[model samples]
Target: MIHIRFSDNNYGGEIDLSGTPGDLRSIRQSIIKLLQAQDVQVCIPANEVKPAPYDSCLNSLVIRKSDCSVKVMVAGSSLKIEGTPEKLKVFADWFNFGDSTESGYHNHFDYYEGNEWVDPASVSLIISCKYRGTK
Candidate 1:
């Protein structure tokens, strides 16, 4: 069985994955997909838009990668995201959110509503998971 224990200042839990490689992969994919679904499409740099006009200026995202939120440390010009491998992919997909025309990117959840680059909208994501270990 795959065992994972987690803890944080407020909340935490343990997740156990038990199954074949393909089953584990499916589990991971499901987890990431669930997380992708939680994010709301916030207009970046909300100033350019007219209707909202900074009304819903959501410039930050609290990405709960796992049962326990991982710690992101920004030291100098470097940054660190520390957590389980499965959890990391959730954040990875969000950061790479964009359209196909945007080179070197994968469309995970299709968060980009197509033409968002020029239309001032948001909807984009990409996800992948490789199951490791035997449980």
Candidate 2:
């Protein structure tokens, strides 16, 4: 499964996902579509747009890949989300609040190479985000 975590100072949240490849991909696509559909604007260094009303932003994302599963930690407003590798990838790609680019978000697809559950073919992912206010 994939997981997401959002944290700030004293608050946090998480989301978990478990399903087949198609389901996982669909979930990820939804998140991306939602962000694109929103009226909010993202401020990218190259293409800086005006901030939106909600000011939703993606702070950080941590992706952990394992032999049998994936974990995603998103630290934003103390919110967390979990799901499969495919789903997590979708969230990572579309994770933009008021900014077009995030600070410390990355994907580690070979984290479980030397461990006991190590499987060269197995793949997973994790994500984390940090927000400002309450959800």
lDDT of 1: 0.29
RMSD of 2: 14.4
Candidate 2 lDDT over 25-110, as tens digits, reads: 44455545434453222221111122232233343223332223333343432222344444444444533323332323333433
- In model 1, the clashing pairs are 1-135, 108-125, 108-126, 109-125, 111-123, 111-124, 112-123, 112-124
What are the runs in model 2 whose C-alpha is more than 4 Å off? 1-16, 39-90, 93-135
lDDT values for all models = 0.29, 0.33
How many residue-pair clashes does candidate 2 contain?
A: 51
Instruction: Give the per-residue Cα lDDT of candidate 2 at 45.
Output: 14
Model 1 RMSD in Å is: 18.3
The alpha-carbon deviation from the true structure for residue 39 of candidate 2, after best TM-score superposition, in angstroms, is: 6.5
